[model samples]
Target: MAADITPLIHRVRRWPRRVVITIAVVAVTLLAVRIALPYVVRNQVNHRLQSIPGYTGHVADIGIALWRGAYALEGVEIYKVSGEVRTPFVRARTIDFSVAWRDLFHGKIVSDILVEEGQLTFVAGATEAESQTDVDRRWQEVIEDLFPLEITHLEVNHGLLRYQDTTKTPAVDLFVTNLRLAATGLRNRPSESGEEFPAEIVLEGDSLGGGQLRLAISAEPLAAQPHFHLSAKLENVNLPELNESLKAYANVDVSRGKMELAAEMAGKDGGFQGYVKPFFEEVDFNNVSDENKSVLTRIWENVVQGLAWLVKNKARDQVGTRIPFQGRFGDPQVGLWTTIVNLFRHGFVRAFNPTIEGTVDPDNVLPTGDSADGEGVASEKPETPPKVATDDVKKVEPEAAAPTDQPSKKRTP
Candidate 1:
């Protein structure tokens, strides 16, 4: 009986060795795939990018290798050879990324990207000869045919943004810290036939001039296109500093103050439209000079004169007294004639007589025409009518008729 049990035990031991060998083979195969996949993918991606039309100076770094999967190229840089270069997306130098294991098997590539410290520069007024339409068209083609990757997680530790008017300089800089974004369901479709996907993004930043920003954006997939909504709030920002940023872009300057803003936007046909109203506290205007004031005064005077009669009548009826209205002062040449007209019309000053009060009427009270004596009355008077004759005496006894209080006594004498 003992001898029979020993043979059985040996056979059972052999089964374990067979199981180990199978596992070893599978492990080797997986390891080889993990090492080889990144190089293969990098080469394919680079080759495809180089083949695209009008694409030059675009490069991708070597892919990272790992046990589970490969952590691929740190970043990809694309630039134009002749025109101004603008980078839409940039990866931070401190970022590390990992490839997805399932993506390799399913033929869908995915990346887990992390950003440590980064900065993005935006230049305004730097227009390229190529229209945005051309760029967009090329981008669509690139996404549809060349590159297809789903980004699972995008983590940013610290990021900075600097904006400048390319036509002007001394760019305004903005900084954001501890930024993070996660994305899913990224797919590409042709512009002619549209497809939609879901996405959500959140951001936080501390602006250079002294403010904080909190932002959130979301979108839902639709049949034809995806619709997006965004909400953002900025707190405790100095407006003068912000205005300096806008000086190169617009003609207005903002004085010292604080401001707040909030808004939402939706996307359509590869573009977006939205409305935003900013609220300011204690803002003042800059660049208001005497010359500018004069121009403004002329404008105001023109506007006021149009409604002057109405305003004057209303004021007289309500207050029973004349109100003094004047225009702003600046260059007097432009508005001199209008000012004189208004002054004479409103009896603001007496042009004819130095000592006369402005209240005196220019037509009647002043010495002019028949009223030269300044009496304001006509000088002529009409004469009285002559006495009428009495009726002729029809008979010898007929006599003239006279009032009792008249010359009766005188006639008898």
Candidate 2:
């Protein structure tokens, strides 16, 4: 019995108590790290943004889902570091990111970034002296440097964008809303497929007056410098609604009318070349005569309207012009300012008879309100592509067919 008791004591002493204690401590430390990681990441992001030359902002909140290798941030505001206090150049309500599972495990991270709701306002500096110091690259560089990993995919929804030019005689606030975009193969290097266009992107949105707009783009981002091609089309814009937004910028009412605008552009390195074509099925310049108006203002409005009538193309019921643009993408207005000044300086000369550079089928243009065939759509938004008939079967004796059409030889062969 004494010998058996000694054996039992030895068995009790064999348990590894030290190892168990060590493992418990490690587990507790890991839990603490998991809880604090989001704060640390958010702080790092804020610090990095502040380092940019002319931009400063902070992230309101950040969260991480370690199991999925996903992270999200909310209420990010980036603005100019200035005393004048301008609207935030870029503001995002929420940004979500999800990484590929394999990449997550390999430590070579890449993510599909989603901007749930955001607004980017491009503000013209108060004076030419200030433009030099402002962050003017539209965040192309900042975005590339933001993440440790390359951005492989991108998506956006209901984003808003605006161009505000306070330097003009009357300030202009042009807006685009409900912007949606989808893109793939957006990495800094060649994509896994090694295609010429590393990224293919599609964009759609609404203009200030319910105009439908769409764009297609292909790009080679991994090259020594960025190279890309872009095409855009816009149609069925609401006319009167434009005046409400433009009222502050001009004295008289202006409308886009039954018009369409299309543009094609290409860029490499820092240079961009493009052409914008505007077509008008109809246009009207009206004088806003109200009891509140003074006599001189009414006279001026009428005079401008008259001038528009004289120069406008009236015979074909369509007016159009092709405008060529070239300059650095970073300096979007390099040549644009002169063009804008010329637009007003020689208002009727170009508008009256715009050079017709291209043509479009009016019937194919989607109707914004009602279909002639009585199709009911809740909204004019393009939900699905129009269907195409694919039946290739040949009718032996079609209703209008004569004796013998040439289809018999091909079918027999």
TM-score of each: 0.48, 0.68
What TM-score would you give candidate 2 relative to the actual structure? Answer: 0.68
Q: What does candidate 2's lDDT look like per residue over 216-302, in tens digits?
A: 777786766556666677777655555544345556655435667766555665555555656655665553434576777677767
Model 2, position 107: C-alpha lDDT score: 75
**How displaced is residue 247 in candidate 1, in Å?**
2.4
Whole-model lDDT, model 2: 0.59
Candidate 1 lDDT by residue in tens digits, 1-413: 99979998787677878787888899999889867876776676667656655454233555555555545444554444444545433334444566766667777567665554544544444465321113545655564443245555555555554444545533443444333343444333222234232444666655644666666555443324434545455566666665545444443444455665543333433333332324444444443432343655445545544443332323222101111111112211122344345334433332211110112111222111122234421111121110110111111121133112111111100
Where is the poorest 10-residue window by lDDT in model 2? 404-413
Model 1 earns a TM-score of 0.48
Model 2: runs farther than 4 Å from truth?
1-15, 102-109, 128-145, 192-194, 224-226, 244-251, 269-272, 289-304, 307-316, 326-413
Residue 139's C-alpha lDDT in candidate 2?
59
